[model samples]
Target chain A: MSEVTRPTLSDALTERMLELIRTGGHRPGDRLPSTRELSQRFAVTTPTLREALRRLEATGAIEMRHGSGIYVGADIERLVLPNPNMREIHAAQLLELLGARIVIEPPLAALAAEHAGGEELSALQRVLDEAGRHLRGEDAELHDANMTFHRATARMAGNSVLNEVVDSLLTVHGPEQREILQIFDDRRRDYEEHLAILEAIEARDAAQAESRMRAHLVDVKTVIEHRLQSPR
Target chain B: MSEVTRPTLSDALTERMLELIRTGGHRPGDRLPSTRELSQRFAVTTPTLREALRRLEATGAIEMRHGSGIYVGADIERLVLPNPNMREIHAAQLLELLGARIVIEPPLAALAAEHAGGEELSALQRVLDEAGRHLRGEDAELHDANMTFHRATARMAGNSVLNEVVDSLLTVHGPEQREILQIFDDRRRDYEEHLAILEAIEARDAAQAESRMRAHLVDVKTVIEHRLQSPR
Candidate 1:
C-alpha cells in the first residue's frame, strides 16, 4: 500500500492524452496514436501506459483492435459534463439563468398535470405537507426542502429536458438566492401560500394550477429581490 | 480507389467497439487490446484494425503510446449520450418549443417595462413589422418566423437561464414536433393576435401584455386540441 503512491506517472500521462483527445475533434471511428508512439512521447513504461489506456477504454472513450489501433465511440454529446475551471458568474449570467427558468417552469407544470400519475402526485402531496410543517418552525433548513418540493413537481412533469434544467438550477443556489429568500422565515404566511398552490392542483384545474404557480414564482422573485436590496 | 473494394473492415470493427463502450460502462483510462490480440479476435489484418482505431482516436475515444499500448480517454461518457430520438415531428416540436416560450415572453415584456433598455425595444421594432407583414399574408412560413420573433423577446429579457431553456427546447424540436401541432391556417387572425400582444408590450403595459400572452397561449392550445381531434 505504501509503495502505491496515488495516481502514478501512468495516471498523469493518461489524463494528458485524454485532454488531447477531447480538445481534438476525434469522433466515433477516429483512430488514435500508436502504443509505441504514446509511450515514447509520455516517457512512461509500456505497461503503465497500457494500464491507463485500459482505464480509458473501460470508461467508453475508445475501442481497441487486435492488430489495429483504438477507435473512438459515438453520441458523445449528452453526458452531464462539468465546467470546473469556469470563472465566477457575472450579474449578467445570474439574470440569464433566472430568465431561462421563467420560460421553462410553466410548461413543466403543465406536463406535470398531463403525465403525473397517482404515485407521483402522492409523493408531491407529501412534499407539500412536509413543506407546510417546515414553514412552522419545524425544520431549520426548510429552504432546501422547499426547493426540493418544486423539483418534485418538475419530475412529475415527465419531460426529461425540464427535469434536467430544474435539477441543475436547484443544485446551485447562489448568493442571490441566499440573500433574497430570507422572507420565507415567516412560517405561517409561507405555508398558506404553498397550500393554495397545491390545493389548486389537487382540484385538477390546470388553469388554476398554472395561475397559482406563476403568482408563487413572482412572489419568490420579489422576495429574492427585496433581500438583495436590503442588508442582513 | 481500387483498394476500397468492400464495406471497409475497419469501419465494422469500430462500430462493434462503440457498442461495447456504451453498453459495457467502460470508463476513461481503460486499456485496449493490443494489435495482435485484436487481430486474432476480429480475424482482421492489423492494418485494417489500425484504420478503425485511427477513426476512434479522432473521436476522442482512445489514444496510442510510443512504447506503451492504447489507453482510454476522458469525455467518453459524452461520446455516446442518451437523447429522445423522435425525428418525425420536427415542426411540431418547434411549436412545442413555443410551449416554453409563452412562460418567458409575457413576463419578459413586463420586465422590459421595468428594466429593458431603450435600445432593446428599438431592435425588436423591425421584427414586429415583419411579423405584422406575415400576419397579412406576406408569406406562409410566418408561423416559423413567429416562433423566432417570440424567442427574440425572451432574449430582450436579459435573462441567461431563460434564453438557455428556450433554446434547449428548440433543439429537442429537431425531431418529434410535427406530430404534436397543426397550424390553424387562420393566419390573419393569428397575426392580429400577435400584434395585440406586441403593442401591449411597447406601451409598457405589463398587465395587458401578460394577459395578451396568456390568452394567446390558451387560444393556441385550443386550436391544437381541436386540430388533433379532427384532423384532415
Candidate 2:
C-alpha cells in the first residue's frame, strides 16, 4: 500500500483530461468517453484513471454517475467554489464569514436595486413569499428560503463573479447558518428585514437597499456576537 | 476499467477520513496515517483508498508526497477556493473578474488604512518597492509583485475570509492577469497608482485610500474594455 506511485503521472493525466475536454468543446452536462475508452486512450490502468477522475469529481470539473456515465459538472465554469471538504466551521470563522458578507453583499443589494428587471424582481418576491410561508415551519426549509433570498439578491445584482463569491460564502457556512437560525431566536424579525431589503430593491432605491442590507447583516452579526460571548 | 466499484464506498471513506482528521485534532501540515495504515483502519482495498485520497488531495484537504507519507493540506480550513481546474478564463469572465475587484477591493483598502499597523504598513511599502524594481524587469516577476501588493493589502484589511476570497480570485486569474499586465501597457502608471494607494493607506486617510483603489481598478478595466472593443 505504501508503493511509490508517480504522483506526477496523476497530475499530468488530470491536465490531459482537461485538455481533452477543452479540445473537444465539451460543455457541462455533456458526456465523455467511458472509463474503458479513456483508459485505453490514455494508456493508464483503471486505478490510475480513477485517481484522476476522482480528482476532477472533487473539484466539480466532472461528475461520475454510478450506472450512468461521466458528464461535465455544472460548477466547471465557476471561478470560486465553496470548499466541499469544509464539514464544519469554527465560531471565529463564522463571524469572519459574516464580516465578509457585511462588506460584499450590501453593495450587491444596491446593484440589485439599480439593475434588477421586472421579471427578476417578481422572482425575488416569490422567493420571499416562500420564506413567508416557511416562517413557522421547519428550520431546514426556512433556512433554505432565507439562503435563497440572499443568493437571489446577489444574482439580481447582475455581476456573475460577485454572485459566485456570495454563493460560495453562503454555501461553506450553511450548517452553521442553520445553527444561527436556531440561536438568533427572532424569526419574524429576520423575515421582516429580508422583506425590507426586497422592498428597497423593488422600489429601485439603491441607497436604501444598500443601507438596509448592511443594517440587516449587522443585526445578525450583533446577535451572533452577543450569543457567542454569553452562550447560555 | 468501468468496473462497478462502490461509489458509495469512496464517499463514505472520504467522510470517515475527514472525521479521523477532526477527531484526532490534526491541523494543517500535520502528518496523517500512511497508505497502509489508512487502508487497514478503513478496511478498504488500495484502489478504493487511493480514490478517496485523490479526492481529498484535489480539494487541498490532504497532501500525498510521492515517496513521503500523507499530510494534512494547508488549505484544509479555507472556506473558499479558486477552481483548480480552471485552465482558461473567457474574455467575459475576465471583465467580470475586474468588476468584482472594483467592488470588493476598495472597501478593503479603506479598512487597511483604518486598521493596518505601522509594521504592516511598512510591509506593504516593501511590497510596492518590490513591484517598482520589477516594473522594468521580467513580466512574470512584475506580475507576481503586483499580485502580492493586492494580496498584502487584502490581508492588511484584517479579515481572513476576505483575504481568502481575494486570493482565490487572483489565483484563478493569474495567467490572464499576466496578459493584462502586457495589454494594459502603462507599466509606469500601474506602478504609480499602486504607490498612491500605498501612500493613502500609510497616511491613514480611509476615504482617499478607498477612492484611489477604486480609481486604479477602474483605470485597468477601462483599458481592458477599450482594447477588447478595438483589439488592434
Candidate 3:
C-alpha cells in the first residue's frame, strides 16, 4: 500500500502546519498564524483553515485558546490510545481483547526469545518469582505481579511501540483480570504458563516461546468465555 | 491471573461515580456532584475525590468545567488511537506497524472466514476489484483501494473493536503505503496476495485464509526491511 498521493486543501494545510512544527522552529507554546493570515497564505477560506486547525487540535498537535489564538500543544509524536470502560465492557468485547492478545503476544514472545539479554531475562524471572509468592492469594499483589510479568516480557521484546500497544490493551483488561482471579482458581496454571514462557525465552527458543505464549492466552480466553457463558 | 482484591479509596470513589453515570440516572450532559459534595458523600477529602474525578476525565467518562462543575462528557466505551506521522515515519516504525499487522490480520482473516456472510464477502470482492483496477496507478486512489480491501476484511471479521483498531493502524500507514507504491512495482504481487486471501475467505477455509494473510504481511515486512537496508 505504499503510494503517495494528492491531498485535500485542509489536509494540505494541516501538513504544512505540522511541517512548520517539525522543523523545530516553533516551540510548544508558539502561536500558529491567524486563520485570516493562514488562509491567505495557503489560498484557502477561513473555514477551511479552521477545519485544518481543528484537525490538528484533535491530534494534540496544537491547541486553540478561547479568546487567544492557536498554539503548538505537544510534540505530536507520542501515541495515546483511549481507555475502554472496564466496568461496562461486555463478554464480546472481552473475547475481542483476548483475541488481540492471542495474536500479538506470541509474536512478542518470539521476539523476546531472540532479543532478550541477561538483564531482561532476570527481570522476567523477578516478576515470575513475585507471581509465585502471590499464587495462592486472590489479592491485588498477585494481579500486579501478573500484569508486571506480561509487561516485562513485552519489555524484553525490545520494541517500544509493541510494548505501548500491549500495555494499553492490558490496562483495559486489568480490572476484569482481577475479577476473574477472585472468582476462579486459575492462578497456578497461569503461573505455570508464565514460567514456561520465561523458560523458552531464557533458552532462546523463539518458536516454543511463541507457542507457549499463544497457548497461555488461549487458556485465558477459554476461562473468560466460560465465565461469560455462565455469568456467576 | 484471576485475582480480585480490595480497592483503594480513590478506586472505590471512581467506581461510585461511574456507577452513577451507568444507572442512566445521569445523562451525558448531567453534572456530577461538586468536589466538596462528592468528597463529603464519600467521606473522603476533596483532593482524594478530585483525583478520582481526574482519572474519570482522562477516560472520557466526564469533563470538568474549569469554574463550573464536572459533567458526563461521553460514555467511556469508545476507543481511539492517535494517528502516527506517516510523512515522517522512520523505517523502524514502519516495520513495527507491519509487524503489528502480521499479528492482527491473520487472526482477523480466520475470523472473517468463520463469520463473513454473502454481503460481507461481496464487500470484500468489491474492494479487491477496485484494488485490481488501481494496480497500475501510482496514485492516491490506488492507496485508498488497497486500504479499503484490508478494512473490508476486518469488517468481515465482525468485531467492532478489532475493526476500529485495524482501521486506526492502517490509517497510520496509509501515506507511507502510497509512497512505497509510487516507488516500487510490486502492485501485481500485492494484488495476487489479496486475491488469495479473498479466495480463502470465500471458500470458508479459515486456516488457509490466516496463513495467506500472514504470509502477505511478512512479505510486506521483508520488503520494507530490505528497502530500509538499501534506501532507493
Specify the highest-lDDT model's number.
2
Chain B TM-score in candidate 3, rounded to 2 decimals? Answer: 0.66
Per-candidate count of clashing residue pairs (backbone under 3 Å): 78, 0, 12
Candidate 3 lDDT, tens digit per residue, B1-232? 0111112554677788888788856767888777777768788765455546655654457777666777886546655463433356766777777777787789889999999999988888998888888777647887898888888998888776677678767776677777766655588898899999999999999999999999998987888778778887
* lDDT assessment of candidate 1: 0.57
Q: Roughly what TM-score does model 2 have, to 2 decimal places?
A: 0.98
Most accurate candidate by TM-score: 2
RMSD of candidates 1 onward, in order: 15.0, 1.1, 10.6
Question: What TM-score does chain A reach in every model?
Answer: 0.59, 0.98, 0.67
Model 3 accuracy (lDDT, Cα): 0.74
lDDT of 1 by residue, B136-203 (tens): 55443465566665666666666655544444454445333223323566666666777787677788
**Model 3 residue B67 distance off true place after TM-score fit, in angstroms:** 24
**Each prediction's DockQ against the real complex:** 0.07, 0.74, 0.13
Give one digit per residue, the lDDT tens place, for model 1 in A102-140. Answer: 555665666677677888778777877777666645354
How well does each candidate superpose onto the true structure, as a TM-score? 0.49, 0.98, 0.70
lDDT of 2 by residue, B75-188 (tens): 999999999999999889999999999999999999999999999988888888898888899999999999999999999999999999999999999999999999999999
- Candidate 1 docks at the CAPRI level of incorrect
